[model samples]
Target: MTNYELNMKYYFAPLEGITSYTYRNVHHELFPGLDAYFAPFIQPKQTHVLETREKKDIDPVNNSGITLVPQIMANTADNFLWAAQELAARGYDTVNLNLGCPRATIVTRHKGSGMLADLDTLERFLDDIYNGVANNGPKISLKTRIGKDDANCAQKLISLYNKYPLPELIIHPRTQKDMYTGTPRWDVLEDCLRISKHAICLNGNIFSPADHQELTARFPTEKYPNIKAMMLGRGLIADPVLHREITQNRPVTQSELKRYHDTLFKAWDALNYGTSTLLHRTSELWFYLGCMFKDADKYVHKIRKAKNIPTYQAAVEQLFEHCEPGGYFSAP
Candidate 1:
């Protein structure tokens, strides 16, 4: 690997309801190479107050050992400013705005990619944020899709983003309509690298070390040097050691993976309210983790089907007992 590739910063993208503080803590503990970890979006209310979950997620004490950047999902400038100040008071120096979430529920509220529908309004919103919050408190970063309905919007948003002095901009190369479907528009990213003034971190379809290597090769370091950061979400969860593998050349061993799984399971078991919640959490994680096991179909079905904790435990045990370790899917 080139020194440029080794030096590139790596961030773990926030996955709402999935990359909570607990998960971040454990992921960091088990695999300790990510430069920064972004917490899932904190949905600020009209009252300028944070929800209980939001408060806990961004609380410094909860994320003591890691560099945590709180992400805010809000269309109101007032709410965004308030949340930014509140998090700043909590010792956070950077906050990311969530403008890329493609879920129907979020966009319908005109908060995420929905804002992309009206670039003028988005421009105004960003104007307010840069003038109000970003100037006064922590540096603000943005995570956004290309547009609400089409990839062309991504091309346009690049010009819009270049207008701001944003420290970092993470672009997931799919429009809202794509919704994790189809191929990510690499053309849009290639264009973004050439046009964006801020550092552009590519986020999408990065699921393995090979994927990372291939992507960096596409945009040679000598040319697109501004594209210096990469964010991995589902891929990191699927193979916890992926960042370590790419940056440190550490291969993930089966026993190590099992230990990481066991540690996360025990942590969730302790904090989660009931067996059902615990099962739900672990099952969702296993959905990606199952990819690392050979013949994953054999036990993955059982892991997904398990109804209770004991049943889930048995299924997991059976997986480690029988299945060999290899990987399943390459993307989330």
Candidate 2:
């Protein structure tokens, strides 16, 4: 590993409906390089109560030994504070604010990247939350996009973030308009690295060691000391050993991948969320995992199309039997 890779921290970005506590625990046990795991965003309600599943996800009992940072997605300061305090009481010291989610359902609700559309409202919300949680709650970090529509908005966004004493500012260098398509705006990220007061973590389009090498080559740690971490969501999901690959120069073997998959499947299946839910959940994983195998199109299609648990199992078996790892895995 290069000095840049060694000095950098690796965080697993939260993927809602995918990186649940069960998944986190399993991944933490199998993969050793991740510094922390951020839970999927919890959208607090007016009543200020966490759902049973949400409670379980953040529960220390379920996430022992892992450094889990719970993320809150709220339009209002009160809602965000309530969730932060709740986490603080549960022994969490750091909470991530989710301003990066670009899903239409979340954006339409004036949350996530939608909050970026109106800087005034966004600033007010930030001000209130920062003040409300200043003395008693967990410290707030922010995971955000550059802007709602224009990449250039990063200038004002960085200025706004500078006003606050954030522990870290995780930037996915894409506008809401850009979604996950096209290339990530590396120039905008460079600007953040140059000017942001808080530590900056890069996210987006990082899938392999080559990608990380290119990133570090561009923003060498010796030059960009404030670039504290890299957050991986889709890439990590596609290859659980990505961090190991980058940091330890280790490649994932087929047996290791198979064991990890089986272990994860058994854990989720034990939840007994019913066959349909199990199939749905496992299939969601395959959408990324399938990309790691050679000639996986037919098997992946069968897995996705499977209506029953038996069929799903059969398709997965065939995939493991016929396909080999080390295929060109790309982010989708």
Candidate 3:
């Protein structure tokens, strides 16, 4: 859907490797309200397949009914156009460009948010993606950081974005160098809202229902009353049922959490990934899950130490059985 005509509710940000098709299916079935799922970035020019696990993340049949956007990571316009064509053939209405991934491994390739460093090249890439190739469908969305090192008065970049009629511009305000290290500049974001012609969506550091509520209330509802969408990452992963909690306007019951915890295991079991791989995947979640428990560090430690699924499950059961809900807090 075009940003202007969209309901503009909650669209998810793509987290590579972790948020797989299996993960998306499990999350959708268990806890709903996600308007769309932004699939992990699909790199261009790898004829065989872009990523190891990401191929499944973008498979159409695996993600039916879901408003899926496969993110494309490319430095050149050719790669952008090529990747967009590939995703269109694979049955996606739109594909997002990964101009916001801050992980060093990705940035070193001069891709992801790293592309922002060279605005001239960035502009040309956008030009080609929009007008260079003739793809059947697939509108493009941009997921971007504010700058290469800092926000850098990115209004100039905004003007460039305004030059085209993009579907949406999901801006994560921190630059590639910032990673997830600091608070996203809400003030810079406010400036973006003022100048941006495209409908905007916020992302970064929203960790709880309270954060969502406060931000919603703070935003002026007069002119842009309908503006209501945020792309969540580590925040949602820390508590997958967080969306449900906000909708219900109540605390999630311990039993409900256990059911979710169990569901994670069941879905993981459905895949052919080795026991170690399964455990490894669930362990990555604890960094987010640890935000929920009183003994978060110890809990993460125990979960990390477990080698087998049974051991991991036992530890998980113990943590939640005696768990006291942690308050709205975050990492340093």
Candidate 4:
């Protein structure tokens, strides 16, 4: 049940509204297991101006000493290239393109996974990226789902991806239709690993160290050696000490959780997000952290009902002081 001895590379999947500079910096300081942390996708405009929020997320001052990669979500190669040039000028050596987002709002716009439905267009887009600026600017990596409709579509995508000099192709093993439901289609991913010319990283259903073990075993070093990296998001949020457990070979301590939570809380409080706004954000975090408690439902409810910062803090304290940590809650 332990894959502690395996030398696996780790990446923190960018969860929008959650894994921003604040979360990334704190997590990086607390747990040093991750090789890189991806910033949530920044949608660049035709003007090619990085938004204030996007600029802040990639600010060297904010992300100092953290191996952070900024992700750009653009359907067009022009928009993508413009943003890539901007990022590279900002000193980012690598930038990730988001082709994996499944939200209806994003997909309906013919972006994210929706673009995967058209091979001709997607190829042209990639061609523009590589031929135009990718050769001269920051090396671009991709985060994609298998396809927009059928998981089998990954096979064709891989054939197309093989034509490019991509450093890595991170696959989530799910079609857009699947969203976050069901299990990942590892069968399709296995085929992807077999034919992909580039290195591949698995990025789905890795909720625990054992889950990662199962994935590594299936794609063992003896056979599928190209698959070595895994991206974690909800799993890390659900158990903030997960990286420590996986990389440091340690157990999740209450003290560790307290420190992590308090760090995040104090940081958010500094933003002066207003009492209700701050409470809402903190409560949302507890929605994942609460999963580790024995009576998760009760603790989660109390955290949700909390009206102010003090009440929220009190509810969290109650969970840590009275409730034991161990449950079967999985991130959605």
Candidate 5:
């Protein structure tokens, strides 16, 4: 078998509300294969000020020892430029434009995937931002869905993306309306591989080592030279050592998972966000992590219903002690 670890770059996808800086730091320390971690979208307001939480999320001190690419979600060029300049000043070498977020709230605002609905506006916004950026500023990349409602929109979208000097173009290959449903538009992605001028990073539906192998087989580097990286979001969350499994072809041990769970619990607990916030945050993690254990639905439900820290900790302990690891995580 070919050792893909020697040839491919792995990026951790930016998932809002889950893959925060703390999560990134812990994952980097323990697993150690992801090339870059894309931070959740930072929606810049006209005020051109980063919120306290946003500042903390992208703070160099908070993100030390990791290659973090801060993402910006904006409809107008001014807001995008302001945020990009701020990130550049903070020493980020590249800023990712979030054009692929499929949430309805973001879409209705004509940001995210909604930008694909109006190619004219999208082109103009791109023009202004590309022209507005200073010569010495950080390079701009894009993360986009194929279209808002139709997959065919990728044709024009790719054309416009080709006009810019993007360092990388990360495509999720699903229309905004798809909203994580159905399989990703692989046919559309194949077209992008054949025609796009910039380096292309594939995202969406990469949940296992088999999936990674299938993608590599389908889009061999010799045939699709533009396909440079693979991005994992929910899959990586479900199995923290997923990158290791794919590259090293080894299963994660139960002891490693227990240690990771314990350390993560303590790290989040130390944030002192209070009992309610801590419970809510840890519960969100269990929603994904629960899938790593075989037949863990019963324990997972208990964790979710946990109202206090003691109950949550007890439920987690029961799960680790009783359930076996090595199960596949199917997206819910």
Candidate 6:
């Protein structure tokens, strides 16, 4: 296989409710260069076919230009296999299992971020996947947090990972306890690269090329040299041209930002979603979009509290009117 950097894709990580086809389509239409996108974790083992909403999100008809890696949330071996089959049934060649969900509702079930806390269980989970339950596009990838709550958890987890033959290991080097609180532990990633069996794709706080450079400089992937492939989530929302910056090595222009904001607004308008719905979608995005402005916090407040579309549109128009977006990566 090609080394990580050579094979690296400027990918968009699946954020539940945020990175769906509507959002993905809108993003691609406005700002291009996303290599592949991960669909938000679909509880693969769920009792039925893709529900109305998910069915649409994963629909091949909608995602023509972009490569998509369907992501599944599995709590057990059965869940993993079931989800994989479902994706295959839908004609996907590969799938990603979320080992990084930190939400309490998800983790409490030994799914998501909680799943990483137990090595033995995780081992079994993988064994089941490799055992051939997933006949259609059995290829599986893992997206993970360092541990449930501590640094040691990642140490033990990495050892376990070294034994498996995963296609790729996407690591966000922070514990579940952090809940995105502090900086990612790069040292843990360094240790992981030394022992991991699969290709290592770095994730966590890759908002800008600077962040990407920092990881490459510190970790220095021995086999790959520079593992450029990374998963961008909040970073993309913070700055949609992130892929452009990473690949083209150029800053986004004012026209680019306005185009993105306008496209998103138009998509929402056509969907005929109520003002509250539009506000809800825009607000989730502004969590990072706020960073692009002069008075970010104030702009965020204006977008968030707007009760209706006329009000919300006026706010959005105002925010983008003066300040231009700039970031390697930014925060909520």
Give Cα-based local distance difference scores for all models: 0.86, 0.90, 0.75, 0.83, 0.89, 0.77
235-324 per-residue lDDT for model 5 (tens digits):
888888888888888878898888788878888889888999988888888888888999889999999899998898899889988998
Model 4's TM-score against the true structure = 0.95
TM-score of every candidate relative to the true structure: 0.97, 0.97, 0.91, 0.95, 0.98, 0.91
Q: How many residue pairs clash in each candidate?
A: 1, 0, 1, 0, 0, 3
| lDDT per residue as tens, model 3, 25-96 | 877887787888888887876453465556667778899877887888888777677767777788777788
Q: Considering lDDT, where higher is better, how would the candidates rank from best to worst? A: 2, 5, 1, 4, 6, 3
Instruction: Give the best candidate by lDDT.
Output: 2
Error of 4 at 47 (Å): 2.2
Across 1-332, the per-residue lDDT of candidate 6 in tens digits comes to 22434556778988897888888898987887777889998875456455777778888888878789988887777667776777788789888889898999999999989988778888887777777643435688788898897878676787777666577788888888878766888878777766666776778888887776676667655654435468888888878987777666777787777778788877876888677788888888777767766655676698889897778878877777756665444542
* Candidate number that wins on TM-score, 2 or 3: 2
Query: Candidate 2 residues 1-332, lDDT tens each?
Result: 67777788999999999999999999999876699999998889999999999999999999999999999999999899999999999999999999988999999999999999999999999999999888877899999999997977788889999999799999999989888888799988898778898898999988888888899899887888899999988888888999888898887788877877898889999999998898888889888888888888999999988999889889989989998887535754
**Model 2, C-alpha of 177: deviation from truth (Å):** 1.4
lDDT per residue as tens, model 1, 1-332:
56865779998989887899999999888788789999999888988777788888889998989988899999988889889999989888888999998889899999988888899999999999888864568899999888888877676898998888788999998999998877788887888888888888889988888888888888777898788789998888888888888887777888988998999988888895798788788888888889988887879889888898788889999999998778834652
The list of candidate 3 runs beyond 4 A from truth reads 1-8, 46-52, 133-135, 223-228
Error of 6 at 81 (Å): 1.5
Give the alpha carbon lDDT tens digit for every residue of 18-93 in model 4.
8899988888888776888999999988887888988899888899989988999998888998888888888998
User: Whose TM-score is higher: candidate 1's or candidate 4's?
Assistant: 1
Q: In terms of TM-score, how similar is model 2 to the real structure?
A: 0.97
Clash pairs (backbone) in predicted model 5 = none
lDDT of 6: 0.77
| Candidate 4: C-alpha lDDT | 0.83
Greater lDDT among 3 and 5 belongs to: 5
